[model samples]
Target chain A: MTHRTIKPAPNIVQGTPLDAKALKRGKIFLNSYAPALRYTWDTGEAMGRYLAELKNGRLIARSCRKCERVMIPPRMFCERCFRPTDDWVYVKATGTVNTFSLCYVSWDVRRLKQPEIPAVIEIDGASPGMGILHLVRKVAPKDVRIGMRVAAVWKPPAQRTGSITDIAYWMPINRRSQRTVSAK
Target chain B: MNERVAIIGVGVMAARPSSEHLSFKEMMFEAAQKAYADAGIDAHEVESFVTCAEDLTEGISIFDEYTPDQLGAVQKPMHTLTQDGLYGIADAVMQLRSGLVGLVVVEAHSKHSNLENPNSILNYALDPVYNRPLDFNPHVIAGLEMNGFLHATGITQAQCAQVVAKNRTHALKNIAAAYPMNLRAEDVQSSPYLCYPLRDAEMAKSADGCVVVVLAGASRAQPSKSRPVWIRGVGFTNDSPTLESRDWIDAQYIRAAAAMAYGQAGIKDPVAEIDLFEVDDAYAYKELQHLVALGIYPQAVAAGRAVENGESGAAGKMPVNVSGGSLGIGHTLEASGLYRLAEIVCQLRGEAGPRQLPRAKVGLAQSWRGVPTTSGAVVILGR
Candidate 1:
């Protein structure tokens, strides 16, 4: 779809940049407002049960009969199959690290002294490639690898809460053995 | 897809770290005025308007209510899409193609500097139950994805660094770019890791800017004084939003979007047919990842090697992000897609100034809604 060309027109690039001093000195009129909005999200049937299972030191997942894929963060319906999930299955706490990060910053961009190693752990009983996001702890950040095996470290029953945090974090399975041997 | 739609005019407020002097409305007005003038038509002539914005990012609920007055769109049919500006373009294109609207205006802007805790706002996008509770920073997702992508495709960290170096160097020639730099890939590699495997230098800093585009049906565009860039295809898609369910190694959303777009554009081979590209580079690795998803490269490793060998540079075989991309241009949030569209429009019209491609004809612009969201859009335009 070729057309007769007009000479390239000059672009209209307009914007005024300011420094911190400009705002501080009131050189530019500024209005500041902050909104504090609070929300209490409803954890639905699938996730509601999943969190409860976490509180009990177990991982729960839903299986899609149509696709035969077991999914975590269990949902009522299988998005791929467009069908309601058929059964709930308990997944093994031990899994391989599908991917991980050594996070040196907080959600608000605040620097942290100790890096948080967040990982996507593919639970053993779930379908291949299905994983949940959680922290991998008790191992040096440098030691974390994508394929390393890890198992969840759960809180004591007295301290159990219906939340993902009920499981403190995932630790390298090898490190768990080392700790057990050292304790013995 | 029924009738032809053409981009008659595009106006942009060059991206900056902050636009302290202009309010978002004022930026809109400025961009709209330029666009209307370039199109050689009054705002009154436009039949429909679409504004791309997110309420959380705007700090205003129902942000569409405030969009109309600024663009002379009062008492007109205007709606907002909580998506990237490329989606806005797609909306306008559909409106025009419907034969109901002869002309449409699309606008998207970023007031990113106004956000005090941008990362926290991004955190809100995560799944409240599963992911948000464990959130250190949402960018950890990027780190994990980069690591997974590298493992899956054998693309190295150094190759991703070269994407930063190439795009920043290209920004030097772009008058509208914000973070132009001339540095080696080592500079990016050595930069402190914000989330391990994802460095601070690899992420695009936020910028404030606005983009306005005017699109018209064949009847209106053929009679216009300005040259028109024809819209060949437009497509967008959203993959699974859940962290557990989605593909971490590739941008399935982008691939799906490109498939729909390339099919519509009759682009059997994107690498051979498209003259230039302005794909999302919110993060450096994203550039290579997107290239692979766009079907320009067979896989991430090939896309990575292409960057390493300077094959995607401004002067390379298939020039990608010659306009500096989000990396060098500063990420403008939702308006990013429009900024990419604006760059391609300028290049296709031979108006890119120093960064203009020599044989530009067909071009593609792609965008992704940043972290934790899998929504992405692609548009193809030909002169």
Candidate 2:
């Protein structure tokens, strides 16, 4: 189990970065491509209903009869119980923040003027720790904390578009309410 | 296991930042060509092929339909693994053990530089209805996970920054490393944040590369004059998909995968039996998390100390990522596993040049599919 005289070759190389301008100007010998890949995924039995509920300024989840757990951002099946969802339940609009980040980068990898506070909020009616990723706005990044109680602030019914954005953002549940109860 | 599987040959071609000379298909062909030559066999001799890729990364759906021709496996038994490079190699090892094939090829690569919107590509990987709509950089999850990891384990952010400093310093010896720098801990600690706890310097830069490994059964893989490296054990696992339900601090999937691989390898204590590691460090914090999961450290807090103490460096107790790893070497996405494996093979074969470990007998290669998922694979190699 030894290399008596094994030789090695370089695995990495320094290459000039491709210049798109050169390619566009016909100075480079390469082809250019732009992907227009698009798709409209079926929201399915659970999410279809979830989005519909969001448009009406309400939060919804599916109840798994087998496990007796409510999962938010609802799904058609109970992943743990391995069965189809048995019932639909409307969960509380407020949830506790499980984790959060002050993101200074945008979706396009650009720096942002204002850092976005994104957190995973576990809804009330959903099982404990059943959280969904969402933005928590109106609270200073330094003030956001794990286990903070936040409630969904929805857009006016006229502006609802059957999308997650229908809810403007999650706002910390009030200073007085935060001290009285733990995350449901 | 009735038979053994060995990596007979390895090939890697990396272009930092981008590859202007070759097309994606041509890149795959070039790496495959070198692997076939290294294996001392023609492309036709390789019975089956397993290619690693992701639809989102390639910006093409059904990438498999376009794979066979370049690898010279047209009309043969070729399948695809939508996983990291290490997972594909693990699958090839199983294929060899099944007795259905004497030889197999595992291929993976990252052509990320070609994507006009890599961040958007990553966003598509999130849970569509709930996660994708957040519209922030998909990397934000690393921050969340890092925050959780540090909070639960008491591993300080400064300690993680030390991981960055050490890895970048080690990368200096690696010609293939994209981020090799003469750096200090404070350099990374004071760097701009990508996600808190994850400084921009600590994050792996995207690099384009292809890796192909030729795997053969023990008998079929005779090393008449060359060295022989065998796959003693291989395993992969995926934890709960719900981010809320998982062990936020530890890499549970890595722990399971390492357990299975170590169990099969008959390894009792990794610190004593294993020679070195090339674990996933797509992010610096991940290196610590996976090490904790792999039993190198009893917990994250201890692992952080080991990192700060230089006990994990090449000259220390157990060397990790001596080939500079993905942090030093640019991360090659799906192909990262094979890149790590290639480094291990080079080390075990005693051909790793300046970074080669002395008297190294066994090595481990770890791979995580990256953020927004809780899946990972591990492979144990012994010579």
What is the C-alpha lDDT profile of model 1 across B1-383, one tens digit per residue?
36798999898999999776666766777788889889988777888999999998888889999787668787789999999999999999888888888999999998888887777788778776677667478899899889888999999999999999999999999878889999789999999998879999999988989999999998889744869999999999999978897899889999999999999999998878999999999999999898899988765689989999988999899999999999999999999999999989999998888888898999999999989888899999999
Task: List model 2 lDDT by residue over B126-152, tens digit each.
Answer: 776566555678899999999999999
How far in Å is the alpha carbon of A9 misplaced in model 1? 66
Q: Indicate the worst ten consecutive residues by lDDT in candidate 2 chain A.
A: A175-184
Model 1 regions more than 4 Å off: A1-184
lDDT of 2 by residue, A1-184 (tens): 9869967867988787777787788886643334334433334355577888988778888888888898887765454543356788888888899999999999999999789998999988799888878999878888999999898887888888999988788889886663212221
